[model samples]
Target chain A: MPENKDYLNYIDRTAPKSPLLKNALLAFLIGGLICVIGQLIGDFYQKICGLETDSMRTAVSVTMVFLGALLTGLDLYPKIAKHAGAGTIVPITGFANAITSPAMEFKREGLVLGMSAKMFVVAGPVLVYGISSSVVVGIIYFLYKVLIGG
Target chain B: MATRLGNQTIALDKSVSIINTATVVGTKESEGPLSPFFDVKMKDAEWGEETWEKTESKMQKEAAKLAIQKSGKTADDIDCAFAGDLLNQCISSGFSARELGIPYYGLYGACSTMIESLSLGALAIDGGGMDTALAVASSHFCTAERQYRNPLEYGGQRPPTAQWTVTGAAAAVLENGGAGPYVTHVTSGKVVDFGVIDQNNMGGAMAPAAIDTLCAHFSDTGRSPESYDLILTGDLGRIGREIVINMMNSSGYNMNDNYGDSGCMIYDIEKQDVHAGGSGCGCIAVTACGYIFRQLKDGKLNNVLILGTGALLSPTSSLQGESVPGIAHAITLSNKPGGEG
Candidate 1:
């Protein structure tokens, strides 16, 4: 019998490659569209809502997150993501979907153990890394400031 | 007495016939190429069930009932049932068996459960342990997605190598004596892992096992690829099917002309968005019970060899970075009884 590694190599040689260029192009366009929508929302908050810059940014994020969760609830985001690939994943809206999708799926398991616990099933690692990296960066900044007197 | 052939194959002495079979599939499969061959096609995936798990159980139950009904046998007449599904605890088969109320053997052979059950059921009758038995296997796309890959509404991209889990169930009634379409031989497979870890490319992981079993069946029975009218692999999608053909050719067995795959035949790959093709336990079960069984009954096919391929990977195993081990069980169905030719 052939070694497992050799078999894996054979499979790798024979398996069809994913259409990387097409996927990348689709992701770029769709991700760009999402960013443009976020920018438009920010502008709306700035011009019409009469909000401060910081408050406007928060409002824009909130609106975008709401839209993402709504689309996920309506069962439309997954269909879009099927074609959009990382285009849906790179945006903050994707993060919202990550949380909402599990919540909706696990709802049958009940609210506490099912919905609440599994809500972060997909996004849990994101939050963990995101917060951990921020803390590490904060420590580095603190050390640099103290030692260098900046 | 069923005599053991070379190493892996067992040639049954008595006739063990697949009296009847029934298949139930979801709307997506109903729209597929083999739609006309199925016994029941659900209007929707949900089928008025509150959960996908429940829907799968319901499909299995309906299929089992239909199979028994078609065979002119009642539930009480069946001595036992062998059933399985691609759920966390094999809950779909368990629930269906509970409703069926026959002496049950709940199996977990991943996608190979269909043939695994059939092989066991035929063996029991051949061994005189049972007179009549039912073999059932089911899988629902929604249930499998949530259990194995992701939630139904999750927005994630699947690779082109990924297969669509078939939403269907199939049941076959096997009796100790019948006129034709007999289970003449069985070659049980060993778990063979090629160290493939990609969960998306299940076909790649499963192809080696199918090849192993097919080779064993041929050597044990002293048969060649041309001995059978069709040599079908269960749920080895296009890529896996290609791999099998290449590997078999290198092994000095030419199966290019007679070889077919249930996964590729289940759906129209060009039109259907199923990238690799249909998969899961239901892929083979429905194809065999619906299309192949009909063809065999209509005299279009005389002798057929079916190898049900399964990638034995669980969510926990995949998460732990374990390689996917594969297995395939081969069953030979012939119009003539064993030892005739």
Candidate 2:
């Protein structure tokens, strides 16, 4: 936009650009590492709760949503977002990571009052969409199950 | 060594003391760079040479005036000068020195320019590089913003990773022939990196780098943390200060006795409008080159370990999702001398 204007063009455009191949590889490595952490959490839940792997799947899914919500509050999602870019951000992991970062960051004020209340300052809209869409999906599943009842 | 300008002669043995220090920020009438794209309308001009230079020159000019007053150095007799600033062409320091018309040199290191310049200046005085050296740093809120972010009037929300660049400048002048609290030693710092790519929160991004450089400076010179009266960092702000404290604590070297930061020094947050705190080349430069230099001259602080921190960020990588690497350099300034004062 500044064209050839020297001092007028004060924009910082010198950050290094990683190749797509390198970015993808970095995303894969970091994303896989995060998945390993998820597997560990799921396995731990199963061993402690005595739930079968199939039943644990539901718990894990719910836990993931909660975890995504929590991490989102922690403000850590940005860091992970930076490392894994859209790969981690597109998944529920980004949601949890996002909420938890801001939540935990502001938790010093008081968990319930500060974190729980206003933690969704930036992500409230996305969380609302995520929940509403899930509600609709649940209703459709219920209707299908009722029609196909044994 | 022989002197072309004669040995730096101390006009006054107890010369140069800090009498007073103050800084002023500009008004909203001075905000621009990203207004067009960010605001779709021109809110104001924040990044022009007029605005940036105004603040930058005002700061350095005031700082030099103060330094000259505190040091008790007559302006007419200040032989050659060693100076530095953060601008690409070293505008603020250049302007200040040019306005005064004393021989000067331009230096840069992002935010570390002050300390880096000071360290070199101390050595210049000690090793007879010049009669007096003044180190300085200044950044406009708009210019620094446009370079690092969208722009102030862009009205875009900023992440917590952001740091407010205070539109101020700081300067210090070290005389080659001043009092004994004059710069005794100035050790060089290595440019080391810790591979931190996320430049969003520069404090966390640059702590490891600062620690690495500090550690190297100490190790290279066979000195310990306890050897200095104060170990200060330039422009790390609050979070970076915490990280540095944590790193130092983990390393089992407590610097709390006299440890401080230039970022934490600017503006009284409770009273002033500085959001998180100061973070610029000028923050530390103003304090050390302005306040601390006087204190050092007055024997208030006998020794100081000034480590200036910097985040190696260009606008391109931040936009492209690359991590920000960081660097810091440490310089030791003490009054102890090989020759008798």
Candidate 3:
């Protein structure tokens, strides 16, 4: 018998794993399925509402995102996320889920603590950046307008 | 760069023993402090916090007693406590530490609390700061389900990919001296954000974290895939485990050997009606404390690597449309012969 013995006798020594294809396919197929909802929204926003293409695009995107986020907060998104994988979350739905959950959770903390203060818990930084960048672009456009005498 | 444990010709085997371990959870407190969540959810019929605290606390105490009994050590001999729970403020662990009356160190690695606390406790012992340490973590079905997804009684259909959070907890006692395997190495997880944005089913979100950290562990240790006897993952369940294997295999590494997952073992999803599998610290901790630890004591496994993966997302964050990010922690356990007592 060997003087030095190995203590572990039944380690399930096997091979490395790969999970990308299944998940990727899940992402693609389910993700594509969710896009049908977006297409309908686009059509509704354009043909039904008769809104301008660019403005309608933004509005529909924002709405889809908001509803996606709201449903996510209500714990509906994970169910969709499970089947769709990346499909449901890749669109405006995931964004909406991310932005609103904080507000909903904090709503009870009081207006200042919950509603007003909670909106920024996770999404605050992104919101700040978006606003500041938009303002900067507006200022730059105005400066260029003055320079070009437009 | 196989950093063999002291093969310098003069190093004797280190036999590390487990002395004591304990756990605490919010599910047991009845009505002491955590009535707010239940009070609010009562209106929605998805109330969960009511029974969550009691369950968590019961799990903690039971696991602690089991660990202490297994190690042949008493609670007073425990020098420090390492604990984590799926709670906002780690109430499960905090309350346990307060009740058990030991110096405590609270840690969070999401579902990775098992490995996280073990790694910390092992370090505390290995660094010569303490003799015995306990690591524990827990999650309650009612509280976690309600907070993360819907109300307890909401009765919504879960997607096939979603996993069940096991109402679970586990405890492991780490001693400075004894027999068997010791904590040899650890690898911290890297945030593997593939820009995939889905926060609902956190198992899917965290599969990447498991792969990233497991692969990173292999890389950091400079060891090949065949080095360890066991490589375990926490709470990714069937879907997450499949994805992890797929991702790793695609990367020129196959994880078919010595690989089992915590989420897969905790419960029979068919019998239990769990859609996917089990998640939470208890998933890993309980499995290790029970079956896995027995195997170690029985000499079925020599070395093992346990990786606990956690998706770093809160209920509010997921609801806000933010992409879920995740983390994993890896702890290595190896056995050796008895030392000079």
Candidate 4:
């Protein structure tokens, strides 16, 4: 029987047709909306409370994280994530959802080992790489300053 | 009574029946569509275990015990237990065996362990090595994540293509000369690699192997998709399901109506956050034990083909940039007394 066929050829011929443009557009709009919400929160804190820019940024982030966690607990974020795709995942809200969702899932395990331990499952890599990369960049800057006598 | 139709297909000499089955799943799986069908839904994922790994062992033990109980047999009645899980050194199944107190055959077929164990158990009975045997497989999402992907504290962002590891265990008792769904035939699969290196998209990696096995089974048995009431793939999820369907169609067999995936059946993809669907040893194990076996027992389905697919890649292999190899094992079940189609 004719059992021999190029495997790569078969894969290309049979793969699902993805709606690349439409998906990208949805992701863009939803991601932009999340950013807009963050900006609005920042403005509210700055203008209404007379907070400094740095403080306002911090306040906005904290509020967004809280909102993300709350929505996740309510079982509402997944619905939005279904539609928004990467839009909901690219923002700070996604980070918040990452930590909150797993923590909520493992809560039945226990507080210390379950919730507190798994709380980093999604966010721990970000912290590790993020901090380590910054340190490396900081060292480079220090080297440049010392060498150039700036 | 026995026949080797082809290189991979084996027809059992004696009709081996799946006499009983049990499923135990975590809270997330309990919230899924097959929740009510499961034998035990743990109120807590931990089951009072100090760690997630131990919890997985407990789940496996409970599932095996429940199946043995349902079979109306004691642990001594089981000649041997064939089991495996997605944990280092197969600790979950090993620990489970310590509890079941049955002679054990620890297997590792990744997500395909469920069907692999079932096939082996059926073979053992047909070979007259045992009157009754137990087949069990398990996986826990937390433990699997920590072992296979990342630690609980890593807090990684899951790609849309990634699938949620099912937290559950399933056990089936295969007893010769019993009345239940009879295992008639099995098609052991060969490892096939299409050079897909992406770990996040396991379904893609395994789809080609599923296609290979399905095609081989059909050609070997001289049967088509219409011959079976249902043709189920273990954990192909949504993406791999499509790919396999397309591959099948191009290969001159259209399985559009009969084919489905256990991964896609476990949860509502739209309502639930599981991106690609459920994937793990437990995914197919629970689905078959909870849903498909019931249908078979009720005579809703007389003939069905279960193709258990697995991605055979370790974290080390993945990190070393090795391509994921995929394998599938197919078992045919019929409710008829003589294994009649």
Candidate 5:
């Protein structure tokens, strides 16, 4: 074993020297491209299906999630995510990939333990917290509407 | 005179030669820089096996058998086999050993198993315990990922600092005399920990140990950086390689042009998308066997130093918040007369 100080020094020196500016630029480009694709899909849905605003929004979300899963299944999302970093991961497609990736991986383990149970390993927390917080917010909105006679 | 030079190094009185080598890699590894040098590249992940673990065992078996055959020797010619892998109980090596039917020493040095086996194999031969020995190490991406990190289906995002575990196996035959690169010296390393708990950044955890072994080798042998044509670190990746260079520079050994890391050199990082680079017991094993062995045989490189570094952290150890301790063992392979290059 080396002296504590010497080991610490080497560890410090060896820490990753990430290119922050370059990564941020790539993230911005990729994230923006993903958002652009989402908007384009939403526009296509509105023009083609003639759905109302809220329904169109839901359609777009579903479409994006489907695309995310499709890309992830093809193993293309990870490749994109490798370069795009958080850009691809922060979008609806990222969530789709999160759910789809585990499901595909665990499919070999069988549905009960592998697919069904492990599918939510990455996105489960996000889904839980996001839905719970939305429910609480919905309750507050309902109470406000009832009391204020709006 | 005692071959023991300094605290960690031993200068072998009898030369131990690398008789032959064989390397087998998975599809992903076949896309790397050293792919052309591998003996066999499997097109399928399953490799006709039902499971990834079985496939890894198959790889080990094929590599060991192929190496012995390439050396113009049968399995009966190999006195013992030193083999290991990342799997629990080293089942990959054990299962392969059952097939090879040779006396086996199942070693575990994490990613450093290649050099560990080589060091032991050479020592056994040099010490007159064995005339011919085989050393091998293997790792599979799927098997290692499920055991150490997450299931393949978990779809967890790998941080940029995380390295991709190699799916490959490499085997070498070391004997008393052969027309090949010879093992001349070895520096066994001591375990050192810098208290790095993040398993993703293995290169950081292992840098100190590599430096310790390298420095000790130099001090004990009274040899400088200029002695070797290349100073190779096994599976240190990009980050740890830089740290090693910086430490060596500060210590007054300027190893600028002749330094290489097997982990980083195996893949073209930008082209391959292997972020930090390749790792595993197979990383060094394959590179040393395929690339270094070829270069030395062709006399492109006269003398080389190989340091295999391993981050000793199990799944339980990481979860328990134990810092990753690391170790690195070094061996000198040279092409000079009487193996003194």
Candidate 6:
């Protein structure tokens, strides 16, 4: 039998490498574009609605999420994501797509069992880690204030 | 009597011919270079089915029916069928068999299923177990994507090594006797894992198995690269094809001129945006039943070796961080029943 370690090394050396520079550039531009759009929406909420800072942030997020879900439903997000890579994924819109895609795909299986149950298949991991990390950080901050500040 | 050559190769005493074949492909495949060769091409992926899975089954059924019809026989004339697909439980082949009402042997060799069915069907014919048998395999892009990767509408970027599953089906009618393009030798491969864990780089994972099988076929048959007019591998994509060529060259066999891959042949990589190239059971199935069969019948090619490569990994296995194991079964198709052309 051929040596597994040697075989793997050969494969790694021979296989074509992904264009890291091109992907990073695309991700930056697309991600910047989405954030710019979000900024514009935030500006509108601040100037026109005269909302508070916290309320404006919420409004901007809601608007962005709506747009993401709408784009996903129209089947245009995936096309963009194909080229955008992490640009589309690192944003809130990516989370929306993650949730909406499975929901759309599993609608055939029924609303509760298919759509609702499978909706978090992709986004679930992100949510679990994100929330758990936040909680840990919160506990650390609480302990720091209680000990150091006291 | 069928004699075992060396370790894995089998030489059938009686002749088993692929009397006829039919290929049915979806829109993307129909737009490929081999578009004109396929028997039936659907205008859309749906093919009037409610779901992608049903569409795959329909394609399989249509291909099977057309193959039987082209062979000048009915479903009743065929004794049994060896069929499979890249779906959970092999549902596509099972549904197609249900419609055809042929005694079914459903297989799951991942992408290697087409040639797996072909090899077994040829054996059945050569063993005098049945006068006629059907070998069919199918895979739909949407079905495979949802099952193996992500949802159809999921917004995710595929890596460069990722392969697009071909949306199509192909069926061959194998009989105990026929004019030409006979199944002469069968080399069933062993599962070889080089500990490749990346699911996207399926070609890398399957290349070792393809290399192992090819080397065995050459040693057992006492033939070299020049023995066959063409050596076609099933769905190894462009990368896998290159690796096989390089490894085989290092092993003292030069396959530079006569080698081809079904994955690279099914789609125009530049135009189709298929990343590495086409994959899945339908990749080799359509290429063999449509393009290779045509070339052999027209006397343009005499001998060809088809190696069906498959990465045997499930979503569960990938999630559990298990390495992907691969297998490749080689079948030699020649214009002459025995001896060199």
Reference-based lDDT, residue B33, model 6: 98
RMSD of each: 1.3, 16.7, 11.8, 4.9, 3.9, 1.5
What is candidate 1's CAPRI-style docking category based on DockQ? medium
The candidates score, on chain A by TM-score, as follows 0.94, 0.54, 0.62, 0.89, 0.86, 0.94
Question: Which whole-number lDDT from 0 to 100 does residue B65 have in model 5?
Answer: 92
Instruction: Output candidate 2 Cα RMSD.
Output: 16.7
TM-score, per-candidate, Cα-based: 0.98, 0.56, 0.62, 0.79, 0.84, 0.97
Better model by lDDT: candidate 2 vs candidate 6:
6
Q: In model 6 chain A, which range of ten residues has the least summed lDDT?
A: A1-10
Against the reference, the lDDT scores of all candidates come to: 0.93, 0.58, 0.66, 0.88, 0.88, 0.93
lDDT, model 5, position B10 = 81
CAPRI rating of model 6: medium
Pick by DockQ: 2 or 4, better one: 4
Assess each model's interface with DockQ, reporting 2 decimals per model. 0.66, 0.02, 0.03, 0.12, 0.24, 0.59
Runs in model 2 lying further than 4 Å from the true structure: A1-150, B1-50, B69-76, B267-276, B294-300, B320-322, B335-341
> What is candidate 2's lDDT per residue for B224-333, written digit by digit as tens?
77787788887777667777776778787676677787676655533443444567775665556545655675788777778777766677767676565666766655
Which prediction has the highest DockQ against the true structure? 1
Pairs that collide, model 6: none
Better of 2 and 5 by DockQ: 5
Tens digit per residue, CA lDDT, model 6, B177-256:
78868999999999999999999999999999999999999999899989989999999999899999999999999999
lDDT of 4 by residue, B88-151 (tens): 8999999989988899999999999999999999988988879999999999988898677744
Best by TM-score: 1
Docking class of 2: incorrect
lDDT tens per residue, model 1, B80-199: 999999898899999988888899999999999999999999999999989999999999999999899777888988888899999999999999988769999999999998889898
The TM-scores that each candidate's chain B achieves against the reference are 0.99, 0.75, 0.83, 0.98, 0.98, 0.99
Candidate 5's TM-score: 0.84
